[model samples]
Target: MTNKAVLYRMVMDDHLCPYGLKSKDLLEREGYEVEDHHLTRRDEVDAFKAEHGVETTPQTFIDGRRIGGYDDLRAYFDKRVQDEDDTSYQPVIAIFSVAALMALSISWAAIGDLLTLRAFEWFVAISMCFLAVQKLQDLESFSTMFLNYDLLARRWVPYGKVYPFGEAAAGILMLSGSLVWLSAPIALFIGTVGAVSVFKAVYVDKRELKCACVGGNSNVPLGFVSLTENLMMMAMGIWMPIRQFVL
Candidate 1:
């Protein structure tokens, strides 16, 4: 037994007190030390926030990594909790987004032909509205992102807060691409963010290997190339700004 141990830091939330007690109990059961930081003062909270740079309450700092609030705490202690979303809804979400993208992206040309402004608008609408699936998950869905990277990509996977959070922000851009006016600006911005995400996933990630995004994409058959294919979509995204939403 090491004399110095890493403590699981549980910062209490008024709504999530059960989480704290559950964490404390689970830690004891697991033989890890637990430290409870029931923060009530703004100064104390600020100090903790400065150490971790997190804005939410009910945060957990485990071995210098912030485990985030309640949902995360539940995911940690209970396998059933985490698997609940993955086994249950990931496929459904994928199906919804896939169908929306395909139905719109395919029939889009029939609307006015690809080169025409109306047809172009339909593509943008498909992509943006289709991203509604993203709102189904938060930064937590890919909690396994880092772990899945190293084993599959064959390199060190970075564990950081920014990547998943960036995905959340990208969700907004996905929605923004629908508008006639804001579409151009938001499309450019979304593509740039996407490029950065790819760089991180490929060069910065372990082995530049692609992770399985969704099983069959409902019926879309998204294979290994699908990951690379999105990069091309990033290329296609450039056309979005071309029309420039002239009113």
Candidate 2:
């Protein structure tokens, strides 16, 4: 008995299928002797597809049995099929989680008891600062992407450049528990603008875009997560003013 696999993939001059390369690599990595077959011409590819009764390219066969495409090959090896352009919530989750924990720890150490509301406020403040830092890291890239859907940034270009600084300032002021008058209004205005922009872009206009919240390089989708950040800021903005004036 021979441990052999056959890979039928397209390798045309203008079009080379990535899945085919991945399939070939996977077979080689798994210690199989791969018999490589290339469908270089359009007619050859079309004929192969029609003959195999398959819709897509990069078809694999092992031990005289069909193994399908790249995704199917992964399933054969019990590996997770990765989506290359998929957006993730990991960055947001990590930042918010760390911010919340830090806030809780600080509140506990300072007051000798867990001040839930105060900790929540700190979480929002810290999260804003962390997000602002990400934006500030690559201001030009962040601002360019931000202008795509942000109402203020689209209308007034300088607002995109100033946003990160304003966000950081408000977050720091809130964290210090002072200058509530300045921080509150700034937080409220930005938050409201952000929420509205996200809503219109994602829901109303149905535009699929990346969020500039985490950074310019982030692959986070511009939707629920972005809106949540804005809502948190708005809530904190309202809460801070009331806490300062009333209690």
Q: What local lDDT score does residue 37 receive in model 1, on the 0 to 100 scale?
A: 62
- Model 2 residue runs over 4 Å out of place are 1-77, 81-84
Predicted model with the maximum lDDT: 2
In the range 1-247, model 1's lDDT, one tens digit per residue, is 6211233233435434566566666556656666666765667667877877776556765676766765675576564455332333445356445645554555554553335444434443444444433322533443344344323223323422333333334334433444424434444444454445555556665344323333212222223333442453455456655645432
What would the per-residue lDDT of candidate 2 be over residues 1-247, giving only the tens digit for each residue? Answer: 5578999999999999999999999999988889999999999999999999999989999989999999999999999876868888889999999998999998898777676788888889999999999999999999999999999988899999999999999999999989999999999999999999999999999999999999888899999999999998998889998999998
Give candidate 1's TM-score.
0.33
TM-score for model 2? 0.69
Query: What local lDDT score does residue 156 receive in model 2, on the 0 to 100 scale?
Result: 96
Tell me how far the alpha carbon of residue 7 in candidate 2 is from the true structure, in angstroms, after superposition: 21
Candidate 1 residue spans exceeding 4 A from truth: 1-124, 131-135, 143-181, 203-233, 245-247
Scored by lDDT, model 1 comes in at 0.46
RMSD of candidate 1 to the truth, in angstroms, is 14.9
TM per candidate comes to 0.33, 0.69
Candidate 2 pairs with clashing backbones: none
